[model samples]
Target: LAKTKPIKRFNSPLRKAAALFKELHANNGSKIIARSTTQDRMTKSAEYFLAGFFGLEWPTNVTLLLAIEDSTGVWNNSLAGYYNCNNSNNYRSAGGNNATIEWYETYLADATARLQKLAPGFGWTPKDSYDAQSLCAYETVAYGYSQFCGLFTYEEWQGYEYSIDIQFAGNNAFQSPTGRAVGIGYVQEVLARLQHHTIDSPIAQINVTLDNNTATFPLDQSLNFDFSHDTNIMSILTAFGFTQFAQFLPSDRIVPHELVVSHLEPFAARLDIEIINAPAPVKASRNNTDLYEEGKATKYIHFILNQRTIPLHRSFPDCEERDDGWCELDIFLAVQSKSFEISQYDWACNGDYEAVPYGEVTNGVPTQTSS
Candidate 1:
């Protein structure tokens, strides 16, 4: 259970969210909406977050809604979208694993030789070194520490991080065929809330039963909380047209880029989308010191992931550059309105199109095959 896990106590950001909510005076617990998958880990995470947000008796204050995480293809769960995406389950989705393997062979060659020389006849291969790196991460989470961590240098640890980044890029980000398809559901739901309307039809992977109703899918909620996996979060970022993460991650080398999955979706990652009200339109400061503009725009949208502000103009050209990293709320909604069509969810998930080779697609949307 997350309650008993030592890592849960170390999640300061989750607790920080609760503190921010309190500071904002958002104390009407009944107005809060908390959603998570039926998976035990996610459910427990939601419970822990709510316990901090509301109180120890969170159940009475706010309902914890659970979406199904089954693979039967009978249900649509935005919180667990990969299950509803059949293409995401097939061998084609192994592009990430394959990319990681290619990178492992390249980066771990020296480490394998050095480690094997330390113990001549143990038959240590690159795979063994990779396994040691994996153990370093897992054992740290499971047992709080691992002897395997000190075996690698800082550069090797960086290689390990890049390997994971390549995996996420291929498996769940722009490099995967179903990347946008699996995330379009949540994207559309967020759009509905921003546009102030209930989803009229099942256009993507959304649960129509919940979305079509106003009770479970309220459009006027002041705060919305949803729990999801790291892969889904990566795909969600892609589906939202965050092109900053669209760069192709090469297995041969770690290039300079901002698609680092560890920073983006490490365990207990949080993405906060804030709607700010400004009395006048704001502009960038001349000296880059956060000086206020003469007038304030009526509203602006701010996206903070893992406590880092994502500059909206960096991804969406429609969003004007601002010093505060906020985009006009209306422009942000407009950019998202076109994201559904760009995702090509219907064809990407269910079409008979031939699969594009790995590394060819880097925009989270598959190309149209020639007739």
Candidate 2:
């Protein structure tokens, strides 16, 4: 019973996320569509966000959406699709578990042995090491400091952090070559909503259609909110071909300077995609001189990961070689649609690795070819 007390805070990171949302969508009267996995913490996360964004107490007018955590159920649960899918190529069926276990043993073996010797009778197992790290995080946030924190030195803590990264790399992100399949449904939904079309994937089973109806799906809403687990977020990022989250093995020695899960999947991580309207560039020729003019404004989409702008790789046809990863709205929809067309829910979830390689950006746009 290490977690004997509940951790409660009004000004948690979730509140900060709400503050950011309010700042970005101020005075717009935006209705939020909050969704989360069927976990208590995830559902409460949605509630906390509503309170902060609306500045209201409990029982606010906001509605929190939840679906059964099953891939094949009538309800839409893309978060759990990896677990429920019968795909032999999926993480569970693949070497995901073994890879993680192997990495843990390789990296944490010496430190765990030292911990067992330090705390005799504790019988430090891999689970205990993970729990100790979890307790350090929980108690640090909940009570400002944890006794478990004192058990490991600074280097051991770093190793512990790397251990979590290995677990995520092996079990979630790029678990197999087709590991990104788990998030295809969500990606499809994003494109469908942007295009104002009904969801085409049977795995999503989303009842609402993007028809400018504020009651169900609002096409004009300035912001949309979804609360999900770390794995789901990772899967979504991978589906977008974010190379930063690629799997790293123990042999890679990618520690101390690699992707740290603590920062990526912290207490309250956010993934934001902003749609902005801006004037299009117009090229004009006058008197043998080329003049560039700003044309009628059009919409564009950019991604924000943890409050930082994520540069879109230039392979996407619409993604120019600019620092800002803004892609024309129509082009973004078109690029994402390629993924939707190739994603076979049954095949992807059922371990058909040969169906089609996951699509990636190419020649400034997404192509059928896989990267």
Candidate 3:
């Protein structure tokens, strides 16, 4: 679950999520799978949610799985794929793709130029701008409000928010050809879990197991929770081909106001995929001579982003459209399986990329060209 910081104001959403989880799986004997990044804030977020679930003060009995290592260039954890493949052309030194940095420079030029006069002796580079923006969010969440929040005018904060939007778009979405590639490993693992099967990718080498027998990797669990940085979430969304967020920059002068990161990966942004069983729709055979009914009921999958239901604009084959973003379970699995089959993890991440962009190869097919 994407959540805000562990502050009191953010407690309601976590409580609501806990209540929903309990309501759905309380008696099913399904285990709660909790995983998070190594960062303290993320760990604390998980702890707060667990407290809400068990109604305990500390909830120390609840085991929180720490998945990512706090090291550089570590590919062991798929959840930290962007950091693992840090040198990929998909990112800039300040972070994000070349275009993202360009946008940051263009949009923040006025604000940054005035920073020395406004804040006095405050020199701002692209990285400084990024860090200041991050500080604003961090301090606000930690203390209910932040002193740094007052340093910038409302217009400057808007520019800072845009800076983050471009960064996410260029490095974690389809706008950059390599964006989806960084997410393929996690996608493979998700597909494996859905099938109750083991993943064969290099991500399996990290000691994270999905054998259906391990307590941490039980296949029968109805709810699986993973906590990580916003980069991973954005990457997964891109890998799944959610084109609604695939925003491209037409020119350096234009700012994508619609593509805001505060809404996408705010303090507590949660993306929930729900699997539900509903009556199957009856359909006539291709010949129109006979009726076809496979069973009384079928499973459908729907997505919830930040408590809002987002309809699928594109999905697997044979998936019937619904206003509530529901797709056939079988079709969803098939689509994910196809993605797994096409994803050559090792080759894409480590092999020769002289002819193609990193993370663009799927089953030997190139989804994008080298630029």
Which predicted model would earn the best TM-score?
1
List clash counts for every candidate, in order.
6, 7, 4
For candidate 1, write residues 217-326 as lDDT tens digits. Answer: 87656677889999998999989988889889888998998899889999999988877665566555446544456764467788899989999999999988876788
lDDT of prediction 2: 0.56
Q: After superposition, how far is residue 168 of candidate 3 from its true place, in Å?
A: 0.7
Better of 1 and 3 by lDDT: 1
TM-score of 2: 0.74
Poorest 10 consecutive residues of model 2 by lDDT? 1-10
Instruction: Judge candidate 1 at residue 165 and give its lDDT.
Output: 94
| Per-residue lDDT over 1-371 for candidate 3, one digit per residue giving the tens place of the 0 to 100 score | 22111112225878866665555555255345667767788888777777775667433334577775555664356666666644234322123445455666666666566665666666667656656666988887778887667766777676666766766765566544445656766676666666677643345223345323356654556566776668777777776666667655332554544556788788778888776654543342234533335676666667787777756644333566554566766877776665544433444444444433322322222343334
**TM-scores of the models, in the order given:** 0.88, 0.74, 0.74
Candidate 1: misplaced stretches above 4 Å?
1-31, 117-123, 286-297
User: Can you give the lDDT of residue 168 in candidate 3?
Assistant: 72
lDDT of 2 at 340: 41
